[model samples]
Target chain A: MALSADESSRLGELLTSRAEQVTQQWTEIIAGQLRGRLSQAELVRQVQELHRAMVDALGKGTVDLNGEEATELRAVLAEFSRGQARQGFSATETATGVFALKEALLAVLEVDQSIETLRDYVAFSTLIDQMGLFTFESFVRTRESLIADQAEQLLELSTPVVKLWEGVVAVPLVGTLDSARAQVVMERLLQTLVDTGSPYAIIDITGVPAVDTQVAQHILKTVVAARLMGADCIISGIRPQIAQTIVALGIEFGDIATKASLADALRHVLRLTGVETARRQPRREA
Target chain B: MERVPILKIGDILLVSIQVDMSDQTAVALQEDLAERIVETGCHGVIIDITALDIVDSFVGRMLSTIASISRVLDAETVVVGMRPAVAITLVELGLSLNGIRTALNVERGMELIAIERADEPYDERDDGPIPEPTASP
Candidate 1:
């Protein structure tokens, strides 16, 4: 509900004239809720800024919470919510900071019994409620994006392609192979294959926890993709249990090579490239 | 009027596809190469596609056909230097170029062809165990 022009002017005068009282009461309410989790000086400054913006909006006759006049107030609330979210404040706790203003304003407006003041007071309460919900929504959105960014970084970190030899590279996978991660693995492996022009790649899955049919299919798809780029893929680290699972599932890797360990796979690739690993002898009795 | 050139190197035929081939051009190349393979009696064919960016189903099918034709002529066909993007797109487009051998580059492709030719006729003496290399004791 919007406050009438006259009511808006009357409330605006009350808010600005009684600004100190409103800030005091609002700080007390929020400080009580936060219990010194945030410093008193910080809390007081935020309360004062919100109170001043609300008063300024009321004076400008901006009763609509989403109107152009409320832009500054919205931006302040968004920043506040984002900060609170990063500071480890719960959603309820962060939202209570806005809700507490309603109580503070009510206490200040109750000193008078005028009908116009009562109407403006209710409008103010509704505006604060909308603003509070907006802050909570912004907080949740920021946290979600932060988590998504970290998850992407983790995915990229876990799938590192190392050049094991002149014409060979290896991807040491160490986690669950979901469809998304599988796509990343496929893309990175293909790109690395082209960059290195390596004819051989070893996909070491020893660190991979387990492999079902779906995982086996992902591995096969990756191998086929690499082979399409002229690089043969050797899937190493086929544990006895994983081997049993593959056989039980009737999943055939066909011509794609499989190895029991990374070392054996490396040796196979080395032999394929015809680079024999010869050991040197010690000098005669030093 | 653009035609992919087929060069004869010893007993091997080298075809480097440099143009964006239309279906007609791809078919022409296939015909011309098959004729040249017979005329020259080449034992190996190397198709270098390093410059060809997009290998749609038409070009891909042409490659498979070329490989099949060369096989009938007692020659091995090796496709080499397929870009990563083209390979990925080909797979996504449901064309794996099955039965077609691929190599990293033309040199490797030639080596592959040489190996294939060297191993032909199945000599029993060639199958004997290789002697180990040992340093002087």
Candidate 2:
């Protein structure tokens, strides 16, 4: 059955958060649950099959697993029942645990459905009715609504690391940089700069996606914000697409240092104080 | 470009791919997604692309990068429903996905994460071929 708008959004948020905690970050807590399973290979294959099921889910033609496939699975499991996990990581993947997990998740969803009365976001409810359109896309559109709920509630941005070096703090952004994140990055970096009383903050987005007007604006905002905090902000990691976007947007980052990578940005940042040789390894997300 | 939510099986964020996401929107999406991943606190993000025809390098890079950053921000990323052709392009580019993971389909990725969560081991056992579950007629 369909859940109410408020109920769905709330439940959606809960599920979303819990899911992220387990899957996104490596949790040391779940390590011991996978010691003994009825069968490991069969389970892995089951997991693989489940993923395959998500691809064409409804569309991929189906065959009854009840016939030969089920028999084959049993045979495979019998052949490979030695260990529950690979080299390591079994405490978290117990076969009984997985079976319970499946049941628990289904139970969770059921519980979530019971709270669907309050209207959280109208659009989210619309998404629910439109069967095929309510998955990941809703997450994108409903983001603004979600973020408005709280600062750290939505998604986790980098924990601003305010590094002090010769009275300067530098923040380097790596990986596919986008506008929304760039906005968040800008806010956090600037706030940290102000909070730490650092005169220079460097933002390296070499890892950012194709730069566009929005990203350029975000850079501009960071620079401006840093200036407001009585600090200087350096922009680096401007990819080709981003450069093109900046030019297209006709926005000039006045006095902003643009570099090719985080290392280049660091060199420039360090060179500002005539200490160009001070080199330390910069950490970038993978 | 329209965004759709397909299903959320636990922490796996299942999204329907936009058949046509422009370069700008693609980046915006990565941005938007970055925000969502942080907001929803979902563990894994899955983008199903069976409905899509052609996704440029921009989209691929954005998704890959977003997936990585999302993970750093406490979310794993997965691209599902990718057509075979799209898969070939991604591999040929020698893209730097590094820690970002993907599956032939969303369910597979979810299964992996779930199994990973379950800490299911490196099982050499092949469960033969899974018979496709029949869609309701």
Candidate 3:
């Protein structure tokens, strides 16, 4: 129902005259609902700003929400939602802050015994409800994007390819070997191989918790890629358990070298690169 | 038809692919490389793909075929200087270029060929240190 200009002006005047009382009641309701989760100063400022925006929107008489009059209200709501997410407020709790304004306005309107006051009250309630839901949605979206960014950072940190020697590079695999991480592992290892002109690569999976058929296939595919790049790969840090798992799964590593430790892999690479170390004679015990 | 030039350095044949490769070009390269390997009696082949931006499956297969044919001719094949993107794309496309050797550059490729040709006790790192001669008294 369209609110007549007369009714809108009357409601606007009531909001202005009772601004202090309405804001006080609204602040109390929000503070009680939030229960000391947010700083009192911040809560008071946000509540006062929202109260003013709502009053202005009502005065404009364009409460269609999507109407231009609600633009300021939408901006305030979005900023409030983002702040709540940053402050660790749940969506429900944030929405409750907006909803509490309705209670405060109703209490202020209780003094007037007129049907027009009641009608104005209903229209304000609907507007606040829409604002509450919008805040909740914006809060959820902000939280989701934050989570995705952190996950990407963790993925990058997990995969690091380091050159171990003049002609050798090593990737010490940790955690589970999912396809996504496997692709990262392959890409970094191959790029390092090309960059350093290393003909030997060691993929150490000792930090990995378990090896299944899929993990084995990912490893084999990586080994094949290194070979194509002119580097022979050695699978290192293969614990006895992983060895048995490989056998049980019938996964053949073919001619690819397998070593029990990184040291052994390094020694093997050194030998391939023509680095022969001479041993010293043992000293007599004292 | 522009032919990707094959330059021979000593007993090694070097082919630097500086042009975007079409399927016909890759095929011609395979045939030309095989003929060059035979004519030069080269012991090693180094194909530098650092200049090529993309290596689709067709070119990837051609690389594998070149390695195999060179192997049959008794010449070790080393594909060198593959771009990072091409390597990732090739692996994603599920072609590992197995049966091929890779080097980071032409120099490393030459070193690999030298090592292969050296035929010294290459795999054995543990020959007991020669017994020190007894000190002259």
Residue range B1-137, candidate 2, lDDT tens digits: 55544456667667677657767666666677777766766666777776876656766666677767777876666665544344334433544344545554454567656765555355333547789999999
The count of residue-pair clashes in candidate 3 stands at 3
Model 1: lDDT of residue B44: 93
Please estimate how well model 1 matches the true structure, expressed as its whole-model Cα lDDT: 0.86
In candidate 1 the C-alpha lDDT for residue A95 amounts to 94
Per-residue lDDT, model 3, residue B45, is 92
Candidate 1 chain A, poorest ten consecutive residues by summed lDDT: A2-11
- Please give the fraction of native interface contacts (Cα pairs under 8 Å between A and B) kept by each candidate: 0.55, 0.00, 0.69
> Cα miss at B14, model 1 (Å)?
2.3
Ranked by DockQ from best down, the candidates are 1, 3, 2
Worst 10 residues of 3 chain A by lDDT: A1-10
Per-residue CA lDDT of model 3 for A2-63, tens digit only, reads: 45556556667877899999888888887876767788898889988987887788778754
Give per-residue CA lDDT, model 2, range A1-286, as digits (tens).
3434344335445444555332222122223343543345544454444223322221221122223323443333322222333223233243332233333334334444434322333333332223222222323334444456555543255535458476466665655456566666766665555355455677767656566666666666656544422356677667787777778878777776777776676677777756746468899999
lDDT tens digits by residue: candidate 1, A132-196: 88988999998898899999899989999999999899999999998889888888888888777
Off by over 4 Å in 1: A33-37, A110-120, A282-286, B9-11, B39-41, B121-137
The docking category that best describes candidate 2 is: incorrect
User: Over the stretch B39-129, how does candidate 3's per-residue lDDT look in tens digits?
Assistant: 9788889999989888887777788888899999988888888877776677768877767777778898898888888885553334478
